[model samples]
Target: MPVRKLLSGLIGGMTPAGRFRHACRLLERADHSVRGFARLGQMAGSGMVAAQYQVACAYLDGIGVPRSPLEGMRWMHRAASAGHVEACFSLALMLLVDPPGQDGADSLLPTAWPEGIDAWPDPVAATHWAGQAARAGLPDAQALYGYLLATGPESVRDPEAAGIWCARAAQAGCPQGDLALAVNHLCAPDQPPGSNPGAVAALLRAAESGLPTAQYMLGLLHERGWGLSPDAAEAEKWYARAAAGGVRPAQARYGVMLLRNGRGNSRAIMAAETWLRRAALAGDREAAALLGDLHACGKAALPGDHEAVTWYRMAAEHDHAVACRMLALLYIQGRGVASDPDQARDWLQRAAVLGDVAAMTDLAATLLDRRDTPPATPAQAAAPLPDFRAMAQAGDPVAAFNLAVSLHRGVGCAADPAQAAMWMERAAEAGVVNAQYWYGRMLLAGEGISASPSQARHWLERAASHGLPEACIAAAQARLEGYGGPRDHAGALAFYHRAAEAGRGEAMFSLGAMYGGGHDVPPDRTQALHWFTRGAQAGNALAQFMLGRYLAQGLAGPVDRAQARHWLAQAVAGGVTAASAELDGMMLADDHAAP
Candidate 1:
């Protein structure tokens, strides 16, 4: 026999009460036949609210019928209008929570029912039914009505009325009601101090009922001393509980706390790493970044380099600027990855766009190095090159210096020495030592701006004080030539020696010339030869030419004719006109003496 026929025959002789009980029993069984439920629904009359509600639940849950929310809602509405409290609450929830579908169809009940709730959700109807059930002392309805009254649309929101309903639900032992009331009190800035105790009590009730959000809130209260004394131990306990319950923020906070206090405890360190990894996998950005740093530094027994790269890449993909910058450095240095300048530059540009100052400086330097090369991809070609002027205007000193270099060299921009000089001065004023040296040199030479020897000397001196070798040499030259204030031979000698000791070829050549000419100290042929050799080895053309001539004439030491010719050849190749002329003369003499 078909199950529906069998169920109909079995219930055919039962009284109305017995039939309702039979239907409820069938609906409660998970394996009851759909056809059986459909027959029972047909038998349920409008007056039998219990049977109607049970049949409606079967259709709503697809328990024993062809799931038809429309049929279910119609029966539920019939029961609710007939004063069934649970039925009214169910109907209210369906109307309030289920939204209408895109084509104006009711999402909750797709099939048409002549007397269903509505084609679209009706919050007004939901509120009416919920109020009716709530007034009948239903705890769930009371809590839900209170929440809706406080957070519903403008016309329905009533915070004071919400409080009354919430209190009623809380007194009936509703955890959600207690949690909401606690949150309301916590959010009210004008609440009296005495209200905090009530809020804490409510939160405790909710937390004790195993609500993860309430537990997390309690942890925060203890951690931040919000209406309570700050108790790190208590906070950690609550955080651990909430984190185990899958609260993401609690997971992150607990992980950080463990890591901070796990210095000498191996167990705590491992626990911290586990929690941090869990939080990071759950999409906590701070947890991911912190994990990256720990791995990068090999902190708490983490594997370095390779593991750091993995975590940093994760955080960088999430748009963490510091992580992007760190990842760029790793790529540039081949730390746990192949050395890839392009990849490094790409990461650097990403970080720079995210407002990282160090990234901006590094990115500018990289761009300048590759300015002459063709862009590697269409995106690179289409992307407008970094605008140095814009960055400089935004107050980046490195950008100002880069802009000056670009303008002076006509690299990706028109050559404009005047503008370059102006930018250089700006960079110098911003305390860039290299910019100070270059700006000072430009001032002395009057390359773009009017010459100001005194100002040039001041800038050069400032740069030299910061230990710039080039600045030391420039400052020495200014003093030696009397271009900046009166010539000071002693000061010039001191500055030249300082730069030469720092391995500056120009300073070495200057020191050799001074010794050979007896300009600042007693003439010392040996000292002159030593300085000239050092400068020549450093590739100074003038020094090479002077050393070659001296060797050819045996003025400073025993002549080595072969070494003299080699030095002269190097000088000529380096574009020394005097060296070229001297070599030509030697060749001419050799040709005349040929037998």
Candidate 2:
């Protein structure tokens, strides 16, 4: 039997109350017919607010009547105008509700309206209806009215008025009202310190009512010791509760705390991973990047490069700069994927565009290499380059260094050594060790800057202390030549040894010259020959020339004409002017000795 018929038959000959009850029962049925609801609506009379509200709900949701929000809202407006409290509140809620796909505070106000309608869910209409409901003592309406007053259309944002309504709603047991009151007291920059007590009380009330955002805020307060003693344990407990309630930021914080402080507890580690994954899936980019790092580094029980790549890609697609840079490195090293320089460069470019300083530096180096040897694809050739001056001004040290290099070398830019020196100095001050060495060299050479031997040595020593081999060698030469300070052969020899140990070919050659000339210590022909051989093998053309001449004349050891010719030829290929003359002399000698 149809629900409407059954309900009508059962209620036949009953009292008026019974008829109304039966009508409501019929409307409540999931399969109730639209025509039957329309008949019941007529019988209930225009003055019956409950019946009108039910019919409006049915129309709005398409429960029995045809889905017509416009008609539903009209009926609701009629009931509300007749002083039905719930009808007023419901109308306000429908008007103020956010459109789908947006969530929480970021949700956009509804804009849809029925065909031929001028406006529906209008902010002004919502505020008017909400005000009526609030005046009727509805806590939810009071809270909503307060929020709308503070954050509605530009003309309606009255903070003082919002505070009054919010206080009334909170006193009447509205959780949202309590939250608003707490935020007003805590977050308003103009609020006095006296408001902290009220903010904490309001937050406590909301948290006790099981509001997740309130719990998260309380956790932050406890963790930061804001108006309370710092308590990590209490903070973690609140964070855990918030995370369980599906708060994304709370989930991330709780997961990170657990992972950092788990102390090898497998249960804590597992729980942390679960919460982090939940947060990551909920579109928390930082959580996704953290998960990627954990998996990449085999932490929190996640130990797979492929899994790391998946997480990094998720964050990277969301425009996470660090995650993109990490993905680039992984691709370049073939750690979790095939080594593809193109893919690596692509990811690096993405990260650089997202303002990753390290990525910008790496991308610049790659572009410079590509300039020397053209890239295979036009896309690679046309990849957008970062504005070095802009990035440098934005405090990227590597960008300052790169800009300096471009200016100094006139690579795609006008040569301006003065500007280059200025940029190099900026990079050096910003802690680029290589830039410090270069700036020191510029100072020593008076290259677009006044020569200051003392300043040159100062910067060189600083860079050397930071383990820059080239800076160490330069500092050693400065000491040996007494260019900046008093000559100290012993100090120079010590620096030379340090640089040589760090594989500086120039330092090795200097060591050989010191021993061969007996300038620093007593001459040692054996040590000189050993140092020259090592420097030559390390590609020092001057060392190769010296070694070849020494070997040919038997200066350090037994003469070996074959080795001398070989070293001289290698030195000539290395662009040593004296090596070329020596090789020619050997060729002439060979010709003279020929039969």
Candidate 3:
């Protein structure tokens, strides 16, 4: 007879307790049959602990029934409450992994649940059940309980107790127990040097058992030489294994190692790129930055600049300071994208805000030369001044120069010439070329500091050596006027010529005057007229006036009254009063000649 039929006949004459015992026997004898499962369910409903545990297992594992977590947890809780050891461990494990507020049978546990506690992990409840199973000599439960005690909430943490439980589990050959021991050892503080013997041994054992996290930790130990001689090859081997097992940090470290060891090898570069891209996509900023560098520099025959920009932008968006600056450089240089000063400035500012000192200096230089920048609203204009001042105070030379200019011109603050001179001199001493020129001018004019012709000439020459056009012109004037040293007309002419070739309108006018007046050279009216014409076309008011006068008198070449009038009108529009008076004289001459 089938076990279910035999049990049915035997239980009819028996008492209630005898019938219950017969039901348990039938459940065990009928094993995996559908009829046995049906009887087991009935017995579980009637408060049989073993039957409830078996029914829970069936629902959880989808054995001869439709799997349902709600039914599984309900029955598991019933068995666990009735002191089934395996049932208690199963319930704890389920509760430990379930997301907070989503535990299937939470409402059946307690009535005094704390309000607003859904955000916190309910490890304490899981620990309660795991403790009973752990004390019952379940190795897995011992390891879990020890880990929870070691790493759970402050109220339940007891490292000494955790160590004892983990030692027992480890002796029973549980891999997780070894991993827990390693974690505790690594996290211990104030350990004596060379004291990580247990951690290294435990990590090696766990890693050899194919644990990905243990493999990564073992790699770190080898790389850092924590408890052994540093071994790059050993570290690489472990990291490679962990990376293959999908450990993200291991992927990043493995890629970096491959890149370092395989420089100039195309196969190595490609392999490294694959792992780095994986880690970068998983939100590793360091990995993203390394990927950007590889592609940006055309490593492994990759399309360089465009791909670099893509990776750099990814890292930069996450506030990687170096990536932000590199992206800014790419934009400014038009590498793999159209040159956009605005985008470049935006990234540079972001990098500076992230405490990149080099970015702060570069940003200040870019802002100081925005003569053609699109107009911004008042709010946009005023927003960066405070930050600019801070950068200046933090010892950025270009920032100091920009702040001085801002103070002198009253762009974002009151005009303070004294402060401007002070900052300009500081920046000049710091080797800022523009600052050298401006500070020299301030000293020459005594605008905010005592006039010192000697110091002025020295700074002007310093700037002139760097080929600054304005500085050349200022240095020439100092030589011609004997402000600092003996007058040297030859030196003055040379400086004027240098500035004129660099397209300084003021320098062109000066050269024209020197040639026309025969200053330290033979008179050359033709050369004078040539420079004056070039200067006039370059929008120099004095050059326009001189060119008009020369045209009217025919001093350099043939006279042209119409051309003279045109030049005179241009000069007058440029605010040269002498040109207006000359135009009046020409009108009188025309009237006299017509009559």
Candidate 4:
């Protein structure tokens, strides 16, 4: 009962189905022999559906034949037309992965088509064949069909149908079906996305089934508390798994989380460095920038300076705005590189063009400072001014303040106090600290606006709350003098102390005067002497004069004329004319006492 003899004797008498069966047995027995392929090819040519499908697989996979996608698709199309389920599904998968008309698509995909078939791979045709196999009870086909319907082009998309097919495939134990359904649930536009326990469960199932993408998505859900409570440990676990599986984004996320939680842990920091380096090498721009930051700051066990420059340059070339600015700073400061102003300016311009506000401000300020071109006329003194006006109009608060200064000083434009006040107020409203202080001063002096002590006090106090030393002194003066409202000695004292703590010599002198003169409370000679000594050491002439007098009169601690003469001479050098007369009188008294 040799199959060759049986086929030779009964081939003409047997039906097409019987011929296909005999051909399959002959091929199995021949084991890739030339005769076996010839026989299979002959049966496939005779319109046998099963024989055609087998031939298609043989050509596609190069089993006992030279691989030919054209021949494979031709045979596959023939079998599919004859109602071969597997052949239909196979062709659909090929088309889905290498769609027609896409430039540089998979070269192995069918390029030439036989007559009467479509000339190119088409998603619509793929979907049709996938649907055919799905209805034929192929679980993988059902999952693919659902994915196509749910995520394909608008003309072919049908989410309702996709959901049904995905559910069917999932019930049949398809991990891809679960993944597709999970993504649909998590990304549904009409629903509150990412709050579904069912979606989380589906993703977990897919992730456990060894899908790297599913692991990454599950980690994101856990990190953000979508559909569950936020769990950093759980998120890190899944991200680590996905990262180990070669998921680039997962590697970056895992590294960032490790860094955030690893403050003093050397082992965790080292692990973070390893993962972030991998992600950076894989072309993850954020990961590269983050690595640059860690290296620049000497964190994550990375060698600083040179390593920071390398990472930052890589990210900057890829248009990372912050990285570009950081690299520019390194170049400007000559850290890990020779100082190059031109390179710094070029990088700064790149960062500014990429919408980095800090870079824009820095670049503008640098340009203003390095104006090598002399002004052609007094009216155009700041003619080549940096584009602060443009940046300010773009709502940059710092730029607005710079423009206000230019307008007030007639630097790059005509002096317009009214315009300056308007821009200054705008900058102050946007919370620019310097603008707030200047605007308050302007209001107090009526230089650019009406003198309004009440408004000045309000603005100065606002600036003082933000820790501006000059504003604190001004606010204290206003409070003590009752310039805008009722005098509040306690408030004035608090403001003066704040300014003095910030090392404002004027505030120190004011404090000494207030305590010595007993302006609001009983005079404390000891406190007066202490404040005067401190203010004098801080180079306040009035404070030096007062300290000299206090020593001469034995008011605070002692009558030390030697200390008095020393302080009075110091005050005379500091432009206190009264100290010279006091020193002269002391010398005269000393001369008479010597006799």
User: lDDT per prediction?
Assistant: 0.80, 0.80, 0.81, 0.82
Total backbone collisions, model 1: 1
Residue 561, candidate 1: C-alpha displacement in angstroms: 53
* TM-score ranking of the models: 2, 4, 3, 1
Any runs in candidate 2 off by more than 4 Å, and if so which? 1-18, 27-49, 59-84, 91-112, 115-128, 151-153, 192-195, 335-347, 372-595
In terms of TM-score, the best-performing candidate is 2
Instruction: List runs of model 4 lying over 4 Å from the truth.
Output: 1-83, 96-126, 281-283, 304-354, 362-595
> Residue 566 in candidate 3 has what lDDT?
96
User: Could you tell me which 10 consecutive residues in candidate 2 have the lowest summed lDDT?
Assistant: 100-109
Estimate TM-scores for all models.
Answer: 0.51, 0.56, 0.53, 0.53
lDDT by residue for model 1 (372-404), tens: 898778876676556788889888887898888
Task: Name the runs in model 1 displaced over 4 angstroms.
Answer: 1-10, 15-17, 31-136, 148-157, 189-195, 300-595
Worst 10 residues of 4 by lDDT: 97-106
- As a whole number from 0 to 100, the lDDT of residue 164 in candidate 3 is 89
Between which residue pairs do clashes occur in model 3?
none
Q: Write the per-residue lDDT of candidate 3 for residues 467-530, one digit (tens) a residue.
A: 5677888899999989888898889888887677656778889989989985776678898999
lDDT of 2 by residue, 1-595 (tens): 9998997687687876666677777777776565548656875465677777777777677777766666677677777777788888887787676432345432333345444223654787788888898998999888888878877887777788888998999999899888777766664568642247876888888888999998988888888887667888988999999998889999999998898789868888888889999999999989999989887766747567677888899999999999998887666544456445688789998998999988888677557646677777887778666568887888888788888887887766898999999999999998777689889999999997999999999899887764456777889889998988988787788788767765667888899998897586778878889888999998998889889998999998899999999999888888898888888898899899999
lDDT of 4 by residue, 1-595 (tens): 9998886788878877776676666566646445566778987887778889999887776777777778878898899888899988998887766543256544655555765457455788888899999999998899889888888777888889988988888899999888888877765678665777776788899999998989999999889988878999999999999999999999999999998898758888899989999998988889999988887666758466678888899889999999998888666544566456678878998998999987877665455545565544685464345668888899988788878888887767788999889889999999766578789999999978999889888888887765567788889989999988789877888888767765667778888888887688567778888888888988989899999999998998769999999999999999999999999999999999995
Model 3 misplacement above 4 A: 1-121, 124-126, 192-194, 313-321, 324-595
User: Model 2 Cα displacement at 198 (Å)?
Assistant: 1.1
